[model samples]
Target: MDELTSFVALGDSFTEGMDDPGPNGTYLGWADRLAGMISTHQPGLRYANFAIRGKMLQEIVDEQIPLAVGLKPQLVTFCGGGNDLLVPGSDPDALAEVYEIAVADLRAAGSEVLIFTGFDPKHTPFLRSLRGKIAIYNSHLWSVAERYHCRVVDLWSMSVLHDRRAWSEDRLHLSPEGHRRVALRAAEVLGFKPEDDWSTPWPPLDNEDWMTQRRHDLKWAREHVVPWIGRQLRGESMGDGLAPKRPELLVFDGLGSAEAGEAAWKSAHRA
Candidate 1:
């Protein structure tokens, strides 16, 4: 809040910016977008993103949290457990307990911690059954934020995401536009004056027939869901060969220039 000089983000694909591909095919999610915004205000801002796709909550805690705390950044944003919630027999309360512990540790290390609630899956086809689990997790996340005095980017309350355009075809990650809106909302939460309104209504949509919708669902299942389940059964992850995009806190190279720092960062990474 006090003109962040250093920031670190920890989470799964949501924070990793899945589906929001950059020029080099890496993610450029809300965290990177928000970091770009912060750099505009303070060009020398140092940022790191420890988020990796398909990571579970415990894996984040064990792998990324300690490193984030070690960085001692002025700001840290963490969002995880969505992957865990999808697994059969997962407990929301149990997940929250571990999550809270990580939050507490980060706060104890003298950083302003930011956490996010799970998005509602009501409108996401094939994911409707997990709505109750996500709700329970979100409620617990709110309580954790309150108790820890941490800031929250309440994704659950973002009605804009209820629109189908906000979701990727997988229905798990957000589309590019959706990530942009989320970055704006995160900026708002961090006490920054965002240029655009995240709550702005999306344009109207065309209606589709039931048979057409069913065919789309089947295609989605075949293309996305089946492979996801296969990976789960094989104990494989999307992040198997991946590493964090920004593993260290460094000055945002393209800050405040005509080309935004995010583009510069992407280009630099590609090089």
Candidate 2:
């Protein structure tokens, strides 16, 4: 309710900032964008992100949660379980049990928690199959937020994200513009009026015929989907041997340009 002096973000690639590439070739997704907005109001807000590209729910609970607890930030945003839900036989009910424990831990540590639902997958041809599972998991997330009194940013209801333009070429992570809109949504959830509105409609585009759509899907399947399946078969992850981008709750001022943001990121990494 009061000014959020510090924040920590935890989850997988979505939070790790995939397709939304920053200058210096790193990802700067919604969390970084949100941090910048908060700093505009608080002036010296401290923030950290413990998200990697391919983490599962259990990994986030076991690894990132404790670190987030240690930081004791005023706000901590939790988004996990999408990766687990993508697994062939994962159960949403069981995932929520583990998810609740992490929520409990953060709440007990006296931080206001912010949580997110998985973005609606119905628009993505390859990911549409997981819609039911994601919906089930999202229902559980809503219940968890209710029980813990946490703030929620309902990604599923954001009609803007259903557009093809909001996604990256992989049909997975959000595009830079997509992340920008999400940050604006998160700001609104926190009761702040952002500079831009998330609900603004995009300019019109020519419709792709069925054959053209099929060709694009096939190309994406070869470049992205097949390799993802191979990784699952061999028990490997894209984030293997990688570390959290922002491990400490360092101060964030939210630089304007990608170049400026990258310079600050490098300075932070050097520290």
Candidate 3:
């Protein structure tokens, strides 16, 4: 557990940071937050993010993993297969087999690996149906982490994430607040001492009417769910023709957590 000075992240939209936008409207997800935390101790930290939205697990293995291996960063975070498990008739058992090869590759290349389990999706509206599938994949991820001696972010056991505020309107990505908490958790996983606690509960809120809730669900389905289904049917991906935004392991513009730290982090990205 030496202080990891170099890091590479590989994943999909979740790692690309969809809903957690920076001040200039760029995505600054948990990875950057964790980098910022690490930089406090390891100022020479160099980081790269190979995550893109809508990337499948195989795509990540084929494209991103090789690049990461070449960089030979001290640590690699692999968190894909979510988009894979979401497809109808997709097999979690089969996906886990593919996932292990990627992890094994990273580990064999002399880099420590970190992996994330799927979150508990029961509280999510349309995605609640995929709960059992997600659970199955999460179990496999846990076993993989154990067998490979990799660090676990364990997103499934993150109780604070169950709150509605932790999710974006699309219900697939984390909100800014959700990203904040996740960064703290990631820092904890890496043994970095974050200033805030991720498990702190939010203040109580008033409930909406049942009819209003129904209307919101319908709106979500029409806007987000329908488009997602169409893309799946068409074999299209949001990451189609898109390259990794942060391809190199240099000083990422926004790489910090906490309120003041986040402001500075966003400003760095703006430069």
Candidate 4:
């Protein structure tokens, strides 16, 4: 809003750009893509991203929200509560309550806030069980957005994400293409005319036998799910020692390649 001279993004792995690896080994998610687009129009746009992987809603509110508000950005995008929904016995209502306070705080700080709903996980293997919970959380997110008058990026209804190819092997993070689509959708929500269309259908897929699919699921469990459970049991987080890729509001000059942007970001933070 107001030409978006400065912007900050807050959330978890999704906002951190998981599965969408950059050349320099960092994740470059939709927020970075959207910032690149904004920079094209406003070449000197200042932006920062405070997202880290495996962050819960409460952690995001506690750690990232204050930093984002202190930046005094013209716009801020937030997407959280997903990691909380993945945990057993977590309450969606309770998460939404805290989430609402974060939104209110940012809005009160005079920043145009953007929010996102959780994606529909029914199509993902081993994740269908949490579909009901995610739906509940999404509903609460919509209500919060309405109450706060914030823009909403409705990921739950983005049918393109239902395709298997849109997800990473972990089934939790989005694939590179998926992240690109999300960026375009975010641009649309912000009333920007994005070059690509998020709704474009993927090429037709070949059918796989049910047994083969089951085998794939088993492999996925061994490769991804088991490790995730192990980390949970050990009370470890993926972001244990990681820092945000972009920590300060600087000119978004390296919009073309996230790798270049990341290098510049690292240099800026180092100084």
Candidate 5:
């Protein structure tokens, strides 16, 4: 079998399961759901979620990518930089540069395939002011993925019909149902699963009890289940950090870690 053991999810609030008011939001975002799907259908699979809230493109370049490479995942996912668009100054070109660096690093670390996600304007705030910037960044994502021969998951076009209700109250995060749909679309795009495979209905959340239950479930998913599953996938004896065979987990060397990034770039280029 093609050892699809280690799968890692990287990015920001959306990746971390932010607004979704279900078991998924607290931690079991689509990454977790996909992991679960893989496990249920294909036993012995393992996965990890390393997403953090409020992260930007620079952060992924400097920090998240390293962490992912250390795991030695056969498959990896990057869903990032929504917060970059939240403000200004960091233009799409700058963000694209960051993405380019991260992708290069991923390839060097032996990740055979990477799944890169695009932004969803429907869920995006400040679109009127930031449309061009978002489009540029998304375009960069497309271009970079193409360059790297990585798969690009177009979340932007997929989430258009889903309105605010599909998202959480903050309008920034996805609702549980919304996350489920996103997972389905992502799976479809990545060829992880077929359209008919998404027939399993996620728990609906229209009332307070469902909301409260979802909150608790979300917490359990992140703080407990995710880490546990990650550990299992790595095939290591019980412990933290990454397996010995995996590379060092470094998201970015640092914003100004020029020496570190230069070393990485040189090393990767040589490979």
Candidate 6:
């Protein structure tokens, strides 16, 4: 309530940190790093990551939303829906519905929602073939965030236009290095910074257990996050499957309603 006492992260692999291809992947994603930095300044805050690797809008609404509310933290961050665009024969309408549901839930929780914007599909190999659709999808995100008055993190603009090197091996998600940069940028934009500097490289994967864990983590992300994005982009709702089936109809459908700000908090991990 005062400063960010609690922080939550919701999203897909990008939010999960799928950069390191090695088996042991600790998901020190950008959100985690951002929390770390905030903690440096705030010290006693709580950090919760509700992110699932391939989570869709519905998944966040279903799972992450409740967790966020229960956590009762002050800050909630969401970065998602990338998989929605990657799936072949995906539906955008469903994706939007799911997103709306998630946003509604976040607002209801009184969170300072930060939605990361998507970039051009051309940034990735698969999406390269769907450039036009990517623009439409990103535009929809901007419009939706504006409607909710949620804080928009221009990841699309920052990643593609300003810092292209932020992408990882897959050219889709952010690399560990990219996540570090993003975390720092978020700190700068939000005016919060911890003692530890994430600009340097984090320790390398030192063991098989770590690698195995990382591999499992990444696999988990690919499964959940991607499908959700696909569902949303296709214009279908994941919960009841009754949402609209067209992206064009995304407009004028405020069949929805209302919401929620900010604070610095203690660091989570600074070594």
What TM-score does each of the candidates earn? Answer: 0.93, 0.93, 0.93, 0.93, 0.67, 0.65
**Residue 31 in model 5: lDDT:** 60
lDDT per residue for candidate 1 within 1-271, as digits (tens), equals: 6767999999989998888876566777788888887776677999899999999999999999999888888999999999999999999999999999999999999999998999888887677899999999999989999998999999988999999899888888998789988988888888876546789899989999999999999999999999999999999999998899888889865323343344322321100
Worst 10 residues of 6 by lDDT: 254-263
lDDT of 3 by residue, 135-250 (tens): 99989999999999999999999999998898899989998789878878877787755456789898897899999999999999999999999999999999898887689999
lDDT of 4 by residue, 125-208 (tens): 577899999898889989988898999999999999999899898888998788878987887888876545789899999999
In candidate 3, what residue range of length 10 has the lowest lDDT sum? Answer: 262-271
Candidate whose lDDT is highest: 2
Better of 2 and 4 by lDDT: 2
Model number with the top TM-score = 2
> Ten consecutive residues with minimal summed lDDT in candidate 1?
262-271
Segments of candidate 4 deviating more than 4 angstroms: 255-271
- Give me candidate 2's TM-score against the actual structure: 0.93
Candidate 5 residue pairs that clash? 62-251, 62-252, 63-251, 63-252, 64-251, 66-250, 67-250
Give one digit per residue, the lDDT tens place, for model 5 in 45-147.
6566677665666866677787777777777888776666655476778777877888878888888555555555643433456667777788888888888
- Residue ranges of candidate 6 with Cα displaced over 4 Å: 20-25, 159-165, 193-271
TM-score of 6: 0.65
Please say which candidate is ahead in TM-score: 3 or 5: 3
Query: Per-residue lDDT for 1-271 in model 2, tens only?
Result: 5777999999999998898876566788988977876775677899999999999999999999999898888999999999888889999999999999999999999999999998788888778898998999999999999999999999999999988899999988998888878887887888776446788899998999999999999999999999999999999999999998888889874644755344222211100
Q: Among all windows of ten consecutive residues in candidate 5, which has the lowest summed lDDT?
A: 262-271
RMSD of 6: 12.4
Model 6 agreement with the true structure over 1-271: per-residue lDDT tens digits: 2465567777766765566232233445566566655655566656655565655666657766776766655677776666666667766666766786777777877777777777655534445786666566667777778888777767656632223355653456676567666776566555454443435443453545878856755764587557656766787543343221111101121111111001112232322
